[model samples]
Target chain A: AQTVTQSQPEMSVQEAETVTLSCTYDTSESDYYLFWYKQPPSRQMILVIRQEAYKQQNATENRFSVNFQKAAKSFSLKISDSQLGDAAMYFCAYRSPLRDDKIIFGKGTRLHILP
Target chain B: GAGVSQSPSNKVTEKGKDVELRCDPISGHTALYWYRQRLGQGLEFLIYFQGNSAPDKSGLPSDRFSAERTGESVSTLTIQRTQQEDSAVYLCASSSSQGSANSPLHFGNGTRLTVT
Candidate 1:
């Protein structure tokens, strides 16, 4: 069984600053994927970024990037130059490379942007 | 639909009643997924459909919950004899292909279900 863990329950960052949300997971499979999703008040889950387990290089999407440490099974998201729109619930997810693509999610960290 | 569309953005049902939530995935998408999000909680995987493969119901919390997908298009999740604990937001998502390390799910605005 694969399980994702988000240690931070809530986080806040000043506008134009940076913040990092920590995430860790436990999985037996060597091939898999890690993801960060943001859910606004509208209730739509938006893909923030993704990292492939095999890729040693971390994933980056504009202001959103991930520190993917495969050996330690830690995948943390870094948000640089935060904006008010960044206020949302951020979730870290895990997906297996095998047949069943069910995503295992961690309890999200609510991010608040202090203007 | 242009994106994943879930019907009945909000549903209120009584305990012991049955409810059905619908999800219309994007055209040509081969994968569909159902997830539950309780208040102040993470998204819980409920079921998954990939092409013609047998659906994965491993995440379903109980047998009272069942889901069906017609071909590779629309899907419906049914909860029979719903309980208060079943109250949560039902989210639907779709991907261009089967679950892989590369495919990312596109989610729809979930349906908020309230069982009283």
Candidate 2:
């Protein structure tokens, strides 16, 4: 079984500043994929960024990026120049394509961007 | 639909009744998922189907909860004898990896099920 953990229940950052949301997972598989998802009040889950366990280069999507530590089993998401739009519930996820291809999501962190 | 579509945006049913929620995944998407999101809680996975095949179903909350997909197209989740605990938003998603192993799931707006 695999599980994802997001220890921070809530976090706040000032506008134009950067924020990082921490996440960790437990899986025996060596190769897998990790992701960050954002859900606003509209109730739509949007993909934020993704990181491949085999890729040490880390994944960056504009202001969104991930710091994936395979050995440490940690995958954290960083949002640069945070804006009001970045205020939402962020979730960390783990996916094992080789095993069952099922994606597991963490408890989630509520991010608040202050103006 | 261009994106993952779910029917009955909001459903208010009485307790002990049955409710059926529908989800239409994106075209050509073979992986479908059902999840329950309670207020202030993370997404709790209910079921997953790959091309109409569900390998593991132990994630379902109870025997009253059931889900099925039709050939990678539409999926329906049925909850019998609904309880107050079942009053939450039911979300559906579909994924396609294409040639790579890393794929992002496209999510629907979700159906908010309320059991009164």
lDDT per model vs. reference: 0.91, 0.92
Q: What tens-digit string does per-residue lDDT give for candidate 1 at A37-112?
A: 9999999999999999999999999999999999899999999999999999999999887755578899999999
Q: Please, what are the lDDT tens digits per residue for candidate 1 over residues B18-115?
A: 99999999898888889999998998888888874545677889999988888878899999999999999999998887445578899999999999
RMSD of each: 1.5, 1.2
What would you estimate as the lDDT of candidate 1? 0.91
Looking at candidate 2 chain B, the ten consecutive residues that score lowest on lDDT are B95-104
Which numbered prediction scores highest in TM-score against the true structure? 2
Candidate 1: segments with Cα more than 4 A from true spot: none
User: Highest DockQ, which number?
Assistant: 1
Q: Pick by lDDT: which candidate is best? A: 2
| TM-score of every candidate relative to the true structure | 0.95, 0.96
